[model samples]
Target: MILCCGEALVDMIPVDLPAGGKAYAPHAGGAVFNTAIALGRLGVETGMVSGVSTDTFGRMLASQLEENGVSTAYLARSGRLTTLALVHIENGGATYSFYDENSAGRSLTFADMPALGDEVSALYFGGISLVAEPAADAYASLLAKERANRVVMIDPNIRPGFISAEHTYRDRLDRMIGQSDIIKVSDEDLDWLIEGEETIEIKAAAMRGRGPAIVVVTKGAEGATAFFGDASVGVAAPVTHVVDTVGAGDTFNAGFLAGLNDKGCLSKDALGSVSDDVIHHALSLGATVAAVTVSRAGANPPWASEINR
Candidate 1:
């Protein structure tokens, strides 16, 4: 089973009513939450680990997970309010304004993280949870503690607005990156992390030096490239209708991991010997699923039955 550790919160997406101005619609979202949902819908045995609130929005979040076949077993409850992201979309590109201070997911501490059972073979972490205080440190601690024998994947899913203390967050994130076996980053994220005149390949290689065996870099609407040692594989994005790209990257993460898991390349040792052919297959699967996700509104990922690939 894969355990996704990070934020689970509400996304207030705008909906235009026929009668008047736009109103916000609550959607169960958060980078890790979306990936967990995508994995579950793809028929992967997955569970979410986060500090969920008992409030109405929080209950909605949990219910959505169960509805999508994602396990809520690892969630810890609190009386705190749930976090909310007010989304703004311009020509299908999305940005967020978060309201998360003192919220359940944001206030989580190390003590709130659940003990991992042997059933969990892989762990995934990223997003605002990695930028938010206390929770960031807690998740970094979990990564440091339990990554010994398990395959670990991380995507920073950087949102600059969520960051408070840059140095502290970078230190914690660097630690997690070092412990992770697989690292995924958007082209924008890569540019931000490693600013230079060097080629993208060079920067991605730099990320590999930080410790991950495989580095995946995504360029929205263009394609994605995966660097394994000195070899690299690229996959083109499937053409699809435009919709908000809310959970596209998160879903891609799930699809890629699911493909790796299916091929028995989900172990830290297996990754060392995994072939480029296997990585190509995984990248195609990821692109296929992400295409489906971006074709729809919000963070909804297609079920395995819906996929023809």
Candidate 2:
């Protein structure tokens, strides 16, 4: 099983109401949460580790995870309110305004982290939870403790707006990256992390030097590239009718991880020794999944059946 650790919250998406004015509709989402859901739908054995509320929205999040075949055994239940992200769509893209102060997902502490079982082969972390409060520290603690035993993959999913203290956030993220087996970043995230000092390939090479055996830089519409050892491989994005790019990246992470898992290349050793063919296959699967996600509305991902078809 692959365990995803981070925030679980509600996304208030804008909808065109029949009454003329727009209304916001709630959707269970969060970067890590969406990735877990996508993994489950793709028939990967998955579970979630995060502080979740017992409130309506939290229950909805939990129920959605269960319905999608993700194990909730690692979730820390709280009476605290759930986090809310108001998503504004413009030009087929989405931006977020978060209201997370004192929320269940943001209130997690180190003590709230669950013990991982032997069934878990990999642990995935990232998103707003990595920058949010006590929860961020809690996740960092868990990552440190589990890195030795499981394959670790992290996607910072850098949201410039959510960061309050740049230095602290960078320190935490850097530590996590050092301990991770694979690190996935977007073109924008790479620019933010490296400050455009070098080419994307060069930046990814620097990141690989930190510790991760593989570094993946994703380019929206242009597909993704994987850097390992002294070589890199690129895959072009699949053709699809774009609706919105809400969870496209998150689903891509799921697909990439799932592809690795399917190929029995999820372990740190296996990933370090992976071949170009495996890298190409993984990136292709990720692009296919992202295509399926962008061709739909919201963060909806395709099921294993759809992918198989």
Candidate 3:
């Protein structure tokens, strides 16, 4: 089982009403939550670990996870309001206006953690949950506790607005990234992490030096590359019709992990010595899965039956 640790919230997407005005439609979202949903849909045994509300949106999130075959037994329930992101779409890209003050997902603490079973083989971490308050620290602590024998993956999925302080957030992020066995970062995040690394290879190596066994860099339309030691493998993005680019990264993360899982590469020992062929396959799988999401309106990932995985 793979345990995804982060925020679970509702995304309020703008939509046209038949009556002539536009309104917001609630959808289950949040980077880590989306990854968990996609993994479950991809036929991976997965579970979500986070703080969620008992509110309408929270209930919806829980239902979506279960419906997608993601376990919600690790959820920390509260009476607090749910975090909401008002999505603004323009030219097929999406932006968010968050309403997370004092929300359930942002209020998680170390005490809320659940005991992990030996069935768990790997763990994934990322998203706004890493920028949110006490929850960020809580998630970090959980990672430190369970990363000893488990393979760990992380995608910063950085949202600049959520970061309250640059230095502190970077420090926290670096700590987590250094502990991760594999990490996927957007080109934008790469630039932000290292200002002097002229080439992607240099930046990837710099990140790999920080501790991760494998470092993957994703360029929006260009593609993604994975670096390990002195070797690197890459794949191009699949051509697909335009739709709102909401959950592309999350879906890609799930697909990549799923591909690795299929190859029995979810163990720390396997990842430490992963081959180029394995990396290439995982990258291709991720891009293909993300292509399916790009063809849809929301952050909807494809099921295993759809891809015949």
Compared with the true structure, all predictions reach lDDT values of: 0.92, 0.94, 0.92
- Ten residues in sequence with the least summed lDDT for candidate 2: 300-309
Which sequence of candidate numbers ranks them by lDDT, best first?
Answer: 2, 1, 3
Clashing pairs in 3: none
lDDT of 2 at 294: 98
Q: What is the lDDT of candidate 3?
A: 0.92
What does candidate 1's lDDT look like per residue over 1-309, in tens digits? Answer: 999999998999999999999999988899999999999999999999999999999999999999988889999999999999999999998999999999999899999889888899999999999997888889998899999988999999998777878888888888899899999999999987888788889999999999999999999888899999779999999999968798999999999999898898999889998999899989998999999999999898889998864
Return whichever of 2 and 3 wins on TM-score. Answer: 2
Error of 3 at 297 (Å): 0.3
| Candidate closer to the true structure by lDDT (higher is better), 1 or 2 | 2
User: Best lDDT goes to which candidate?
Assistant: 2
Query: Which ranges of candidate 3 are over 4 A from the true structure?
Result: none
| Candidate 3 lDDT over residue span 81-111, tens digit each | 9999999999999889899999999999999
Task: List, residue by residue over 133-195, the lDDT tens digit for candidate 2.
Answer: 899999999999989979999999999999999999999999999999999999999899888
Looking at candidate 1, the ten consecutive residues that score lowest on lDDT are 160-169
Of 2 and 3, the candidate ahead on lDDT is 2
- Per-prediction CA RMSD (Å): 0.9, 0.9, 1.0
